[model samples]
Target: MPGFVALTGPPAVGKTTLAAKLAAVHGAQVFRLREFAHDVRHRIDVDPALFATEDPLGWLPDRTVRVLLDSALGGRGRNGVTVLENLPGTIIQLRTISEIGRRLGLPVVVIELTASDAIVIGRSLVRRVCPACEPDLDADPHRPARAAAADSSTCATCGNPLRRRRCDGTARYELKLRRFRSRIPGIRREAATLDLPYQAVNATASPDDCLRRVVAALRSTQILPCLPADLPSALNGATP
Candidate 1:
């Protein structure tokens, strides 16, 4: 059975970037839950007013779960792994994904990236997302070259013009942080019960540093294959 990894973290903590990096290194497919949610919202023809009255997840249609599960499990026979990005925020979602993994006979691992609330909020305030390349860049007061490019509203990766997402602002980010904090204990408990391989990587470091730590953790946990011979020597050192 091929391996599957589900990554969870607070908003602006770099979960998407880590998932993309892992997928590139392991030649895996990615299933991003945020994108799945958007697809669900569009497919169901949801009323815009409903979002004002209730939490989006509260009224999530059943088809959303089906589509996400199918995408996560559909290519089971393939050689490459599947990397689920930002899924299973709640214990219920975790249990559902766990049951699906067990039924499909796929080995599942969960990795959570963590950072201080201040760092998350600061990054959220400065981040510019690239829709085409799916990497987030710090727009100001960091990454001088990238910041300079971002000043012109161009993405460093794909040269596409960058735009601040609606949910990236202060009010929404605070809400996301609160939600993340509330879910941590339940996620930890459920992951323990399911006996899933779980690891937490500190995400307060530089992106390269965080990637090295995550790669080391994955290798140590046997979720990812061992590093290639030609890979960087820095990765071979203990995860910082």
Candidate 2:
């Protein structure tokens, strides 16, 4: 059975980018948790009211999403890891995730990326992710990333049209940030109680540097066994 590595962080903390990079290196399965849940609910025609909240699928009963969660837990190969992005916030949601991991015979490790609120807010204001590639527009060497993202037609790396999610709006970003900050302490407590490996990485650097730091930290903690062999060159390629 494959284990799961779940990534959670404030808006614009680079979870999507890091997950994509790791997936490429390890042949890991990646899941955007809420998005997958939303699609599942939509297909089944569940209560429309659930879609009204910022995160509609996070609190759904495990029974409702058992098959979807199982598919996510099942990796491509024996050693492949499952990389989860945008993990739900809240102790109840955390417990639900743990239960799913337990039932699947997969260990779940939660990786929380931490950055200054100011940095996160600035990046949030600037970025609009590429739906296909999950590339970070904020990483472009351009000023006023929002304006750059708006002017751009497609992802520079993948040529996919850029899309703005609800959290791209300033008001929604602020709301999400506040909610995430408030829940961090409780999340840490609950994760500890669950005996889950919950780790935090400071991610306030250039994308390459931040990725390097994350890989280094996880290696030191022995949490991620399926790391890339050429870590220095692949992850630290742009570290300065």
C-alpha lDDT values of all predictions: 0.67, 0.66
CA lDDT of 146 in candidate 1?
40
For model 1 the TM-score comes to: 0.75
Best-fitting candidate, scored by TM-score: 1
Clashing pairs in 2: none
The digit string of per-residue lDDT tens for model 2 on 1-240 reads 356776788867888777776776545667765556656666665566543444432244544444455655555324656676767466766777788777767677888999999999887765666665543333221111122354585666666666665546777667778888998899899999999888898889876776777667666544466654554556667532
> Could you tell me which 10 consecutive residues in candidate 2 have the lowest summed lDDT?
138-147
Q: How well is each residue in 1-240 modelled by candidate 1, as lDDT tens digits?
A: 366777888888987777666666655677765555555556566554433324633434334554556664666524656777776677877777788777777777888999999999988877765656543232211112243343567767667776666566677668878988899888988999999888888999987788888777777765566333214444676443
- Model 2 residue 61 distance off true place after TM-score fit, in angstroms: 7.4
